[model samples]
Target: MSFDQLASELVSRKRADLYRERRVLESPQQPEVVVDGKAYLAFCSNDYLGLANHPDLIRAFQQAADEYGVGGGASHLVSGHSFHHHALEEELADFTGRPRALLFSNGYMANMGTVNALVGKQDAVFEDRLNHASLLDAGLLSGARFQRYLHNSPESLAQKLEKTEARRKLVVTDGVFSMDGDVADMPAICHTAKVNDAWVMVDDAHGFGCIGATGAGVAEHYGLSVDDLPVLMGTLGKAFGTSGAFVAGSETLIETLIQQARTYIYTTSMPPAVAAATRASLKLVIAEQWRRELLKSLIQRFRDGCQQLGLTLMDSPTPIQPILIGDSAKAMTMSAALREQGIFITAIRPPTVPQGSARLRVTLSAAHSEAQVDRLLDALERVK
Candidate 1:
């Protein structure tokens, strides 16, 4: 259809809600930032560790730029691969306790690359109903018989699995749901996959660098080994305080993706400086335990305060605590009300969430202080 026709159709169906406007940011990612010339306490970022503005990471990026001269200059398969990328990949392998690791330009690409490469037309892919859009899209692109289970329900997964007859069965889920902030029932899901002889993959985009023992992510959080969950995906931008993402698994898995994953082979590599900064950030994420602890405290404080206010919060123990507002208009109103008080939070509506389940995705960061959490709670109470 013509672009104008498509635009009109969108407006008619109210899918024009997809048209989001962006505000110009004039400062580093922190508790407060300058947006559209107004200073606001920003809660919309994924920088859970609050290391995006750390001086050490900044120095690491600057030093790497001085040495490597910024751009990667080519794709990973070409001349773009550098020492910074190599070192970071090795470090990530170590971080996840995997035999090898491979980097991708972003989390979306990583998910698409791994899922598409691993399973093809002959396979069947089962996913959580609320998995990230990337996973669902990847399954579609794979030409696999894609099916979805009820969110975080292993019984639902098994019922679907019982009917599938593909040559290979794959189960994928988000480690920590981005909007709901709840963790997957990994032990149950992984156990089900194991009994069915299916492969399990987890996209721990929001969990890595933020959860588990020593920040090893969801698998570690639940004490699942590489055996229980063989495929692991993590994004560096969220908590590692840098750009890009990685997949850690068996050597054969890494090599197969390197050889077969179109997304990994065709795209330009991430900046070498970013890899350097990720390395530095990884160090801090491990060495300094206070950040995670403080985040845990903040999450508890927010949840407790919300319960006291009688808000319909989701079942979440993580930092991404979303307040479920069933009406999209109400969600938007809550967002605007908070913004008026200098607090910035994004309202998530369908189809990012289900219809009639729009919400304020209140993300907490380690940079947030007790006073900041109280201020946010006070503002929410006023508007709610």
Candidate 2:
């Protein structure tokens, strides 16, 4: 690999307006933020319930840090699992209505470890085409026969399931598709899997702390028990406003991951302080029904505003609302236009989305006022 080749590729990416950059955040994870020395009303965050900078979580984190120190010091199997980690896992298992739950450093590791541990050379894996990158990577690396069905289409999944003769069959999907902001058809998908004698897994990374009556995620929202969805993977970073991830499932499933999952066996545990903070976050997520209601109202208002502006949005009931723009460069330009108006929305382009389906991914939070949403709508009208 020559350096010139890399430079040429970078230049080509720039020409295509596909180059990526990071903006420096000078404030907490809130609606109003200072990025790159400029203050903007940003809508590109995943903190749906707005608990990231809450005082309770902060106090919990600080107290836990004072008691437990900062670093995990070792892998969970090698003496890193602290009281906070164990308690959080138990709390999470109860929260998700699962028999047991296992914690991982992040969602990627949780998905990778669980899938690879469950399926092997003689087994097969099926996933939705629009699943998050973590699920796709897990399926590919599981050493199982991997197949993809149509997005949220149980018929497509059934067709694939019928053709496979592997010793074990696993069906996987996102409870909530991240980029599109649409909920998966779990009732249909799970039924298809059950008839095929396949186990179902749902990565509810973007669903929890926002959906469901008590914020147990899509599983609770759809009334699916642990029997309906076996391997449940969820991330704390997004909705919980904390860091780490977990897999809630049967006792046998968790034991299998603990014994066979290479990622979990080899990796260091997350900080105890983070786990302690997540405990606080979980309490707020469950108790605050008003937060969910406010999110719904905000989403509806944004959707109605988009309709009035004739802006085509995805069929998403979640807090994620993307305005589709066909051309990548045009999408980038539109994002820049919004930034100029002191509203920060990033352009989502190819590889993240399909070619010519570039979009401006507008994520909302309960922290945002209706006036802020109106300001965004005004910016959209002007940008249009």
Candidate 3:
């Protein structure tokens, strides 16, 4: 708790090779980026659809800014809500096939607020072991009896659910595991939760705008309806290539959050221009099916090339492909070696991932060409 203890802990992290730092990105999120005066073929961005710097989105943002100014200026309940924000929420609700939707400043606040609003001391919350940090923290902050099931194990979840005697039960999981890049077995989880009379919540932050026919995310990918996955959370920042988050569900569910979610009620709303830009991005996400196709092709190409080189990869059909290197030091060394070859891939170490499972988190974007992917494969071949 003391400053001296914090310094000692920082030193310990540095010694263990578990310390994390940020790279100064000199350019926008793209396949090729300038970092600290050096250019690199980057594979670490989450702009899966390559819409982060899209001209249309920029234009939409600019137009909205010209009309509405730069800031929300207040929280949603305090007159910060604009026509742009309302329209975006309506569009999201329609796109997700939900009756209503509510926007939050970011995904972290959305997750925290949603979970906290739904459960309390007399309730029980069960989460997958690999759920996002925000989900875990929300569960703890809810004052619920929180328990974690084995990762992606429906049977484990069922066993835990059967034992909970709380007044309300909530089962939460990430639709796509961020570090592992594997989709959750939502059908099984939903079935188990349904039988146990527990509500299911999915934070499909990474899955949205990258999965499904119209990029409706994991629920749509699995053909799940609103009844099956009642509480759904998606972020605009990742594949949508904007900056905000939303929870889409029943009208009652949204109204309940509007009344009870502290994070949404207390924090200032996101910029109206961001909402306008996201509206533009959402249109592209729905109409431009080719972006998703290109991303899938890139993912397959990268996986095939890595397999041919005998590099270990996680079971991921998505854009996030992690090359497993057991030791943290080895992962860092491989990342540095790739950087020397003008490739920019980040080494993900504990406690992001489990101990002894440090990896190079190589992400793919639609903006990257096949030749660029080949270049990355070639660099990875050398580094590995």
| Top candidate, metric lDDT | 3
lDDT tens string, model 3, 1-384? 469989999999999999998879999888889999899999989898999999999999999999999999999999999999999999999999999999999999999999999999999999999999999999999999999999999999999999989999999999989999999999999999999999999999999999999999999999999999999999999999999899999989999999999999999999999999999999999999999999999999999999999999999999999999999999999999999999999999999999999999989999999999999999987878
Off by over 4 Å in 2: none
Q: Which stretches of candidate 3 lie over 4 Å from their true place?
A: none
Please identify which of the two predictions, 1 or 2, would achieve the higher TM-score against the true structure. 2
Residue 75 lDDT (model 3):
97
Ranking by lDDT: 3, 2, 1
Q: Give lDDT tens digits, candidate 1, residues 259-370.
A: 9999999998999999999999999999999999999999999999999999999999888989999888788878988999999999998879998889999899999999
Model 3 sits at a Cα RMSD from the real structure of: 0.9
Candidate 2 to truth, TM: 0.99
lDDT of 3 at 347: 96
True lDDT of residue 249, candidate 1: 93
Q: Candidate 1: which stretches are off by over 4 Å?
A: 13-18
Task: At residue 29, give the lDDT of candidate 2.
Answer: 95
